[model samples]
Target: MFVHFGLYAVAARHEWVMNREEIEAERYARYADVFDPDLFDAAALARTAKQAGARYVVLTAKHHEGFCLWDTATTDFSAAEALMAMCRELQPHMIVNDRLGIPGDLVTPEQYQPSRPLERDGVPVLWEACQTAPRDAALFAAIGEWMHRHRRAVHGAGPSAFTAPSGVTYTQRGDRLYACLFDWPFGLLHLPDLAGRVRFARLLHDGSELRMREIPQAQQAFNMNPAAPPPGTLTLTLPTRKPEVALPVIELLLWDSP
Candidate 1:
């Protein structure tokens, strides 16, 4: 399945953008925290999209610069290594908890207390593994053998021996609670690293009806509204097909206001 999600509005909510590229690029896919899970993880957001009936999640991992989604050692401006994000200390986990009301097993202060960083063959934390395996995450796993080495060591080591902070709240909205539809604008999206066809539907009457269709674009995802009006949602999933999926417009013409 494909989806047309809104990002500029979300960036606006975060006070991160004033225009098209500025909002979509710096605040999402290309943003430093876009995939931190603890900070900008897409799983929960994507899950919310999926619960709304999406099957593919096309995002702008990189903007016009040919940058990247995760930490790119190639340049210091990458979303993973952008010192600005770390300086801001944005709490993605907390945001997830707040927006989704995850009821996340209630982590105690002791759990949140800063712990010493771990090392791999004397190397510091690598943002590539993404708290999971890489082969499945080619986007984040672009760090080469060095990343693989550390990850192999960690995966082989198993869960943290130290008492870690509490995590995961099943009561999240992204799962299946309030499946609100998100409608993004074409001007608010861009992914230089993606390409393919998109399959999605138009939401109507409070999402009671879903009409399916296919859209072919070089990009990953897009919005239903070409310009602007009532906001809606475009549900989606991650890449698994041989090629990256495209962003097809999934327009909705209704609003919740009177």
Candidate 2:
């Protein structure tokens, strides 16, 4: 909670001048008369904070100078109430500190009164700890380790650069290939560019085997050019309807490398 006001307002310095300059309480109190924060509008501040994408804003009602910005029974000088009224009117969801003699939603208890863990019903994990930079190095390493443990079952070492049909992506390493289907295809699914020694093909998600047909490159009209490599395609027979699950992956075991 930091608001810039009081003697420092006229001094044009930080708000901690009374203590820094060793000014007497009586002499420092003189700024109260001149401390009219005419330009202070909490609604404008709230709007600025919202535009800046700030989750919350804290105002310094009282700095180390011991000046009260809000009208309190203890003092006659306080423009805080007006600013607070503007803030409440503009952003009702704004979080305010308790220093303004106002009740707050969060409580900052002293040591020995630690807060208990919060939970969300039905959801196993509710909270996420967001850390950055040097602190997240270990987190990145852990993710790599997790991926290493599941490497063999994955499509490839990296994602494919070539484009595929909607909801379809394939990974290839040498002769071994794997296909990931985010959406089920009705009837026969064709791969126009797959050219290699055909081998066993099956659905990876479940151990179910799928029948596949290969169009010989020499028989196709596109492979008629002698300079061009034989143009062939692999076709997979698919069910008309999708399975219960959302995405299904298929694995193709090739006998030889292309």
Candidate 3:
């Protein structure tokens, strides 16, 4: 009720459109227009993302300034012409809201209220709080304390320092000398390399040149599926097969996959 009321309040107060073209143009100026819908044909973007080895395509139908890619009956200035027709013409496509406000009584399944991710504003816990509850200083602080490691957020929280084990070398007794990781997804251990790969093998405590190999990708059990992660962790080890060897340097590489 409060959520609807808030949206209503904001919407009602928003200036009523005086002219349609200006409204659409303003949408772009406000950074509200993300996807032109016309720029990329439906089949084309999918093919391109697949061929480019991109895992996902973020079509910015809307941003903070509030623009939607498709036509909205709600507004006269809604997307028309190019892509609006595509959504109606296309098939086998599914859309999950990139923005799910908050979960629970504040939101209903049909109306949609999703928990916000922190990566948008750059700071995970603390910065995320600013984005979501920017006015609420106490809430952000509490979140920051809860996410001391800063890796606990739903989306990437940008570059923050982390701790790792200390060891220069170890015995790869039979096959591998490995390390352990707790409280993280099995994806790339780090991020922020626009160059598209993370190279951090230099942090190995044991100091042995680490070989980059494709370890079998492990599927996270449904129980571990994340709407959010409970304060949890896991252990990871590598194969070395020696009694004494330089510690392995692990490089976390992020790339889209099939």
lDDT scores of the candidates, listed in order = 0.30, 0.57, 0.32
Model 1 lDDT per residue over 60-149, tens place: 454343445456676544443353345347754321111112222122222142244434468544221112222233333233232232
* lDDT (10s digit) by residue, model 2, range 73-135: 764446667767887899998765444655443433322422232233543222222222232
Better of 1 and 2 by TM-score: 2
Candidate 1 vs 3: which has more lDDT: 3
What order do candidates take by lDDT, descending? 2, 3, 1
Error of model 2, residue 252, in angstroms: 0.7
Compute each candidate's TM-score over C-alphas.
0.19, 0.34, 0.23
The local distance difference test score of model 1 is 0.30
lDDT of 3 by residue, 1-258 (tens): 001111112333322231322445544353333322244356754554444333355554543344444567654444443334454468325433323442211112343332332333474432211112223435434433333322212223233232233332121212222232333223333211112232323223344443332222353446643232122222232443432322123333324311
Candidate 3 worst ten-residue window by lDDT: 1-10
Backbone collision tally, model 2: 2
